[model samples]
Target: MAIPPHAQHDTHATTRRGGWPTRRISVTALLCALSFIMTFVEIPIFPPAPWLEYDPSGIVAFVAALAFGPGTGAIVVVLPWVLKTLFSFNVWGHLMAIVANLALILPAALVARRVRGTRGLVVGMVVGGLVSLVASILCNLVVTPLYTAVGIADVIAMIVPILLPFNLIKIILNCVVTGLVQRPLSQALSA
Candidate 1:
């Protein structure tokens, strides 16, 4: 018996403009909105750097990358930064955030794509977290001095004591949350 067109898989399925599958675009947009909303719910995990609060927006973006691929994940990461920057006008902070998040999401997504399975994801998270930690520190050295009263020296001083720990904690939190939810969310979204 032949499968109906609606029920059959189309290997040559038509994509929307920009080559994104329509479903991927829809999922990415929904995840972007969630990530944007999550930006408001920040938790101060590090006392010395309360200003460097943690938000789960990255988790959503990371999951989007894991599910849909890096491009969708990147859009999910940037949309929140754009929206937050519009409201706060903190261009430097938002730019740093984009760098940090993309650092995490891109590597994780790429590694996960290459490796496959839970092992792949675990390795991806570790690699992504370390990359994010390094990127945040480097961005802080350059960008923090531009916006805040802190000089480059001051930012460097804060790196080992404050920034390092804060970013480590933030990356771990995002990775853990993403790992926990990724499979379930992927299953649900695919369904």
Candidate 2:
């Protein structure tokens, strides 16, 4: 049997050279560990909801997604989340956090893979930021009441004043920081 021309050409996009699967698995594990550590290093930047702290764990998954692919990036997000939940026992929070992380990562990685180069990355991040912000808002609106004693009215009230700004700041921070580091990291990984 013969491989198609397009399939042969695109194989390199999906697979790296030299022990490719092993390399992805190892890096995914490393990224997951880093993300787990990051959860502990958060700052209470949002005063309206001080409990809604800021952490850069998303960056680990984003970088992994940018380098290896979405599946590996997902492993980075999920494994840490599962382990963290085992200790914290916050199942709903963990589930929602996964959704939030994927909102940014999926779009950015998909765009980067499809478009290529710095331009693709920038466009992807911008789109991902918007998507993440919206997803965060929607998730908070829907899921906040389930976790908290607060009513839907109170949740709605907090959306603009609290959740919106909090998510905006977080998404922008992720975008800028990840954008700054992604190129160098990609080069390093490829090398």
Candidate 3:
């Protein structure tokens, strides 16, 4: 690569996709670890729905997504939930969760990447939250009804009421925490 004679710094640069970058892995691992830790500390917000709960899994996913990209974020988001679903063996819930994670993380990461400070995190969180909110509504109003035709409707109904607010909190908290942590972590990891 030829350097610009007058360049103050190396403007032409590319990320090291080699060896998965130890630094990037550390950040991803930290967030992944945090995500696991949050699972046990679930805060149940019981009211509109008995199953309403606050889960920080999204935080880690969002952070990873921001640090890495939507692809990483999607996997990070899916892994734990997939683990949970596997253990529970609830196919319906697992499917919904997979869909939810896929919907939320990309928008959050995209927004997060656009800025470089607290504002970025806020934007990511907002975008993730809105995306999740809209997705939940669509799933609730459309997908679930169709899925219920077989034998899932009752279960879907039980989940719908909880879906909106649960996801709202999930995305917001995920975005905020990931946004906050990812910045410093990103700098540290990337450096």
Residue-level lDDT tens digits of model 1 in 66-125: 988898899999998899988888788788888999999899999999999999999999
Candidate 2 regions with alpha-carbon error over 4 angstroms: 1-20
Model 1 misses residue 53 by how many Å?
0.9
lDDT of 1: 0.86
Cα displacement (angstroms), candidate 2, residue 41, comes to 1.6
- Provide backbone clash counts, one per model: 0, 0, 0
lDDT of 2 by residue, 44-103 (tens): 888878998888999988998998887777888888988999789888887878888899
Cα deviation in Å at residue 8, candidate 1? 6.7
Clashes of 2: 0
Looking at model 3, which ten-residue stretch has the lowest summed lDDT? 8-17
Best by TM-score: 1
Q: What is the lDDT of residue 1 in candidate 2?
A: 48
Which stretch of 10 consecutive residues in model 1 shows the poorest summed lDDT? 9-18
lDDT scores of the candidates, listed in order: 0.86, 0.82, 0.65
What TM-score, to 2 decimals, does candidate 2 have?
0.86
Poorest lDDT segment (10 consecutive residues) of candidate 2: 10-19
